[model samples]
Target chain A: MKKQTCSRILPLVALLWGVGLCACGDSAPELQRYELRLQGTTSRFSTTYLSATAVQVTLGGAPLRTELLPSSQRMNVANATHAHLVAHFWLRPEQVREGALEATVVLDDFGAFEGTDGSAGFVDAREAPLRLKLQGDALERNGRAVIHIDLDRSIGAERQGSRPLLPHLRLVY
Target chain B: MRLKRQWLLLSLLVPSLAAAHDLECEVSINEQSTLVVREYPATLTFRQVVRNIHPTLPSTLQEATDPLLEPLGWSFTPPPPVAIPVNDSRTYEFSVTVESLEDCARIGQVPPSESVEFTDTLQIGWDQGMATCSARVQCVPADTFVCDDTLYVSSSAGTSTELMPLDPTTLATTPVSSSTGFGYDAMGLSHIDGYLYAISNRNLSGDPIPHVVRVDRVGNIEDLGSLPELAGQEWIVGTIMEDGSYVIGSFLGSQWLRLNPVTLEVLGQGTLPTTTPTAWAANPLDNKIYGYQSYLARMSVFDPYTGDFTVFGPVLGNVGIQPCSCAFQQDGTFLLYCYTSDPTVDALFEVDLVNGVATLLGSTPSLAAGDMASCAFPPAQGATPAVRPSGYYMIHEAALERCLASGPVKLGLLPAVVTKEDALRLLWSSPAFTLGGEHRSEEQAARHALARQTLTGVCNQRLFGGTPELQRLLLDTTTTLGRTRAMSRLERHLGEANGRGLDVALPFSLRGRATPSHALEQLQPRSSP
Candidate 1:
């Protein structure tokens, strides 16, 4: 009788453990994958490059900083506009609150994309954080969001012709 | 001395303002081909030079109109950034390439030489102000392009939605199609992606959702989707942007919504600084979205990418005439169509975008006071070269002689053709062909014979001392059958001339191959026979 009771209790405990494992798996939120796309207007990009080398996307108090890979950047000399897929990462749906999330994307302008720019010194730059709106449905449906930064929104004239001072930046998502 | 000092002071206060006004842009086709390979794609390259007309002031080349190359398959490539020094001009080269032609070529398009003329405008934004220059470009190899600036207007009558094809040149309306179940009241029709797109405020499903619908050439409405955020909104202004986005501005509120052309998904929404425009159209040359407020007679520009609205002061000098529908002329002229306070006094006015003046061209067919949309590019030229016979051929002996001279034989009698014989038989069979009397004079008999001959085929007008009326009949004879009959009538009239000394030398140019408008102008005013 004792052996049979022990066997029954062991089988029941094992079943409960398996059920708990399945429940935990169902309760945990699935992460949605997304890509960040950066595009500039063709008219302005033909003159000067958007000197941004890195981007940081922050959501729900957590930030994902990405140094743009060489394969990800397309600062070609072609006088045409292109949408560049710069970064890819995953995010939890819980990170989006109320069907919307405000993303603060920090752009670090290092002026070193393909080493085309001959400038060695830093140009007059502003560290203003660009804010973009990420729609929950957009990510849920398209699995990607775009942030377009206009280089024509520069504030002042270039100090020198070679190192054009890009002071102002506007973000459109 | 006071005037000079005031001028100096003005120059000091507004340096770039005057300099910007001196900036001029000239566009020239550097290279173009008359014959294009129908199977392969072709590219057209042109040069645009921004010259500072002012002898002293330097100007920066700021903004330009990125014209939407028409017929759906064309794309433009703008040159690199341009800058002009003092008294110097900067040249920029641009190219337009035919990306595809399979979709734009319509079925059953006739008269292969399709010619289109559209305006390309460049608005050079200087540091302080702006200057604009425009040039009309005639696109060649027009046979490949079938998409013409065919005007389509929609009605504002509640629940009575109708789309009609409007002739831009004649302002005539013909029914394309009409349907119910969608409320299109106060919505403007916009041509986008080879289809007419409009916003419907009516929630036919009884839900609080407004929908954007597409109307095809045959006027079939396809519901794209419903916009929940735009429910119960009255939008009279709508236009298709360069990025294929449909933007609708509110009629009552200052709100506007940019939507996906295919899905009607709300991509962006913003508020205008002032009241929204009642009429909106994208300039084909620049593809810039411009809005016209009929009540205020003011023009406004909307930047689709940034959601920026800039309104200019009154663009029409005559406030008496209110324009409810706005479109761009083929030459990049801003055209507004409407009437004065009196509904019957409506005409199409060409708005001078820079000076805010409007010149009335001619009367157009009045809509139900609704919005109008047309292709930015004009219909390919030489598409409709239908021959219109001269009405003078019936009355003037010289016209008959001229027609006979051109025939294979220079004889008093016309070469008898089967069509002429058939027409004469048909005329004789009718009771209307009775010779007035045997007592009639030779000229009278000849005129009656001419009338009978004309009535049988297309020229059914009796040239009885009404030259203008005869001219009108000739113009109205737009059918091929009518033209053929009129030609035969000319020959028959010459056959009866009896080789008499031609009284008037009617120019051959006025007879055939002349356009209707050209015929009207060339038919010199003459006393009745």
Candidate 2:
């Protein structure tokens, strides 16, 4: 009877321990995630490098603080606009397990995508890139990043030419 | 003399205040193609629809007027931290979390412990130049981006100084083309080979249908002529093909047509993939096209070659992915930015062609432009060809303050696609006080609206053989559906109490540096001054 009681108590304790571990780590991770990517380019009219005063990125409903290379720390934009600009973003690929995503980029208080400037209709930007992608985990060790510099479109002003501002980010995980 | 000129300049500038002005809204998109912070409040469909629906009457609340929501189910307040932009016009969606979706199963409706009345402030960024190739963009932390002014301008206003900080909850208008190639303005968007397709329209007695014209963007305007093939079709929906071909579509006929970019001649024609194509995106793998055709709740794929099509995605009764744009990533995966009949807050879906599954990447109002590269036919998936928002907008005369007060305000609604064959055009108008349902006849109501107009008090009716302003208003909104400030101002100035006077109603370029009031004074008899 004593042996049976001790065995029964051990099983109950083991069950409780298993439950706690499941709650702590064994639970499923989120399958879906989304990110906001902001990219810039110059018009055919100019071949100068253009940079912004501030960079703010938002996703879902929260304001996401994105790391901008050469922020005020280094200078890619020298108080003037350039013919081209390349903004690179880093995001975790595992987050987009099985969900949806929405993204946008706007000018100060305005949606600047495909904007018609100086009373002109939206013009094709020769320097601004037209594509972004999330590199997979094993492929890119620093998480799936939205890269600005690709072989086709180099990031910089052909005149004062700057390569992709930040060569590579310090991979966190 | 210098002092006199300075005084003259000052006084001359003083009078023009009440002129017709523009209103613009800031918007953004995450990886999901959801529009955040829309200029107009009508974009609240995603967040509004995801609210829970009660099968039974609420014990705490009073009553339920429409039982339609009960049929449609709900999800947890869209997994919190999903920012939705709101305004007075569309705030009714916040307090009520319950919604009746089309195919909500067992857990259709749930009650929110607390009601979240959403509030958003417009964020402004650097305002230097204007013209751009695309309308909006979304970025990710999974990537590191450097912000600059040339390619990427910075945001200036809002607590968060991001340019046009858009919330993912907001939605945008469906893009339709009215190509009238008479290039006085900057509207013709399609670029194939050396020619640019434009909208060329005029209000002629027998000619109700506007026409499209192909003009050279870089050369003399006189060398161009009319494009007769697309003459009768008013709203010509189109995108550039892989081998420099063009695929133009008709929303009314649900017909797809292929044309040689050089000749503007129809190369091929086929029925539209969906009954109602909500959005259009280029196939990442090839020049094929994708549309939600939400009227059918399926992703209808279109091939420009034969004009043939295929249905992709689950046909599970109104899963309600109101497709925005069928954009793609660098690897050639399709991202269908979709919403629901209710504002089920926007979501991003990745179309897995291999398994035929539409995966959810995340949720957002817009997608990134960079995602288009390395993919097949980048322009089709939103390359430099993404139709960006026009710089200036027109506001209703009654909404002068909101239009010109500052930033983050909607100036006017775009003159999108208009159709007589079907009812898709009315989907973008203000849903408030709508006496009819979605399937209701918008044309009949417009006729009644025109019948009730009294424009005789104001004379000088010259256009359309001296027709009344009411008649002109309906004609422009329905027939020509254009994108000029003059047309927009004309639409809002009429049938409203507070108006931006007729003198100041002309486009800013024509009216010069005078204020609205001053401009109006100029229009008045010169002797009065």
Candidate 3:
């Protein structure tokens, strides 16, 4: 009679432990936050350099300033040496309208790169159409988006001397 | 021998009193464009330069001669006493008016043959001596207005595209009633004979046939049929001549055609020196067609009679951006509206034809980037009538003082004795009461009040001191036009009263002293004693 009682108590202990483990696995997943990165290549003949760039993010035509990660950056002449830039951003669930955000990036006083050698300067890239449509859900879920840009494909090839290649962007989530 | 020497000395002294001094006087009249049948306030500026040669004594200007300029009524206020120090010079500036210069030119004996030069003699007396100076003035009458100066602008955006009238002064816009249903891109616009004429490339059917149409003030449009040679031509610049004819030019070619504004019939055809004229307007001052070449950005003046073109140097402004339309102000300055890459932003420039410079007036927003047309209506003819004011009509403190001493100051229904305080109160309330709007600031009001007070004291002492008829006119209450109307009438009348002669009536003391004896005689006849 003592051996039979031991066997029934062991099975009951095992069943309680299994139920506790399942409850831990069924809890909600952790909330995600996102950051964006831009990577590009430069052309050898390109002399155009960006001094400062202003980035504006809008959700359905209204400007959104709060969630912009690293809102502004001073490029100076160091942009020519730096091949990559990282900009982090986050958006509230209510702020995302129609599941997208429009980004307009403008280069202020984008003129010729003054080389260390002190050569003649080239013309300025006064205005460039650098607009991007960002996915709201991916930025909210993944916590990171990496963009790849090709400088040659973006800018126009109108000038003969010291022409700057346009940059392209790619997203990796 | 002693008597002869004394007589010779007397002759020398007498001649010295009448001898001319080192003083010079000059008079000039503002130039005008044409002679009209109305009275224009032609400003005659008199400048006197006095050189005092007396080493120890300063020269004092005693009096100046008042010349009678008939036909053109002469009126001038006596200049203030000017003093020249020994061995120094002083200049006295006096402004006078020649009323009805146009009528004077048409009816005068010598009738202004060349540039309308009129000469009059002026004699000035100093404390120690006197001098006579000749005042020669050159004046040309300006062209009178043919119509009201209303600016018209056209739109081509949608079905609501229509012609609208814009106030030349205020830029206030109002839609023309007949601007509906006639949907086409207006390439050019002009006004003649109280009607608005427009040239459009697309007909009502949206075809590529160029047509000229007349639109009335109520927006009723009358199609004048297709332009013969201008079919399919997109860009056109045009202006209305003073004789009611239209000068239209094609941007795609060098051909310019003159047409009867009413018939749309091509009366004459000529070639523009430049290939593409982006904007053009008729300069009534010189009766030449002035325009801008789009390619060269140069100013070109085209003489319609000689068919000759005078191309000026390149205009200095925004490079490569051409004006979509241009119109002339009444003063012959060109107003240009230029096109920009951004559809919403447009630039307006005032081009000085004489100086060859373009000054940016301002920028207008929400205007489409394309070839827009504009036309300015001629200035309104006989709009401002010259009505001279009597002494009572002048509302300043000087007039008020004279009127107060004479009788009750009746301004509308409320008649009261006007004082200096009342004059100041009237001046303080002028912005609201006289101008009918809030057009003056507190600072401006204070400044105007101070100026009026100072002028009143000076003018009253000079004009109302010795005049009986003027005093009677100053106190008359029959000419009062109530309160509201009286302010405006008095304001205009006060403008005319400036620079008028102070000899309208004899001394009030002379008349009053004479009248008391007559009063005594009448009383003696009635008295029983």
Better of 2 and 3 by lDDT: 3
- B487-515, model 1: which lDDT tens digit per residue? 34453433222111112232344432212
At residue B439, candidate 2 shows an lDDT of 17
Which ten contiguous residues of candidate 1 chain B have the minimum total lDDT? B104-113
Q: What is the TM-score of each candidate against the true structure?
A: 0.34, 0.25, 0.32
lDDT of 3 by residue, B1-529 (tens): 9999999999998645533232333332232111122234555555545556655656665555534242344432335366666677655555555554333444333342212434443444454234433333434334321354455666654333565654445545565553444544433344333445566555555656667766544454556667666664653677776655677777666777777654354657877666756777777677688887766777788876678888896655562455566777656767766666566766667777877787777666634323333434443232221111121112233344544564433343323325544433332222211222223444443333223322332334344442222222233223433344443443322322321222133344422211111111222111111
Candidate 2 lDDT, B362-462, residue by residue in tens: 55433221111112332222211111111111101112222222322111232221121011112111111121212113443333222212121111121
* Higher-ranked by lDDT: 1 or 2: 1
TM-score order of candidates, top first: 1, 3, 2
Report per-candidate TM-score of chain A alone: 0.56, 0.28, 0.52
Where model 2 places Cα greater than 4 Å from the true spot, the runs are A1-173, B1-207, B211-228, B231-236, B273-276, B316-323, B343-347, B360-529
RMSD of 3: 38.6
What are the candidates' individual DockQ scores?
A: 0.00, 0.01, 0.00
Best to worst by lDDT, what's the order? 1, 3, 2
Fnat of candidate 1, please? 0.00
Clashes of each: 9, 145, 17
Better of 2 and 3 by TM-score: 3
lDDT of 1 by residue, A1-173 (tens): 55554554444434422323322232443445577665644243333323233456555445543333332322321223665665665555555553334454433221211112422211222223344445555455566666544443321222211122222222222
Task: Estimate the TM-score for candidate 2.
Answer: 0.25
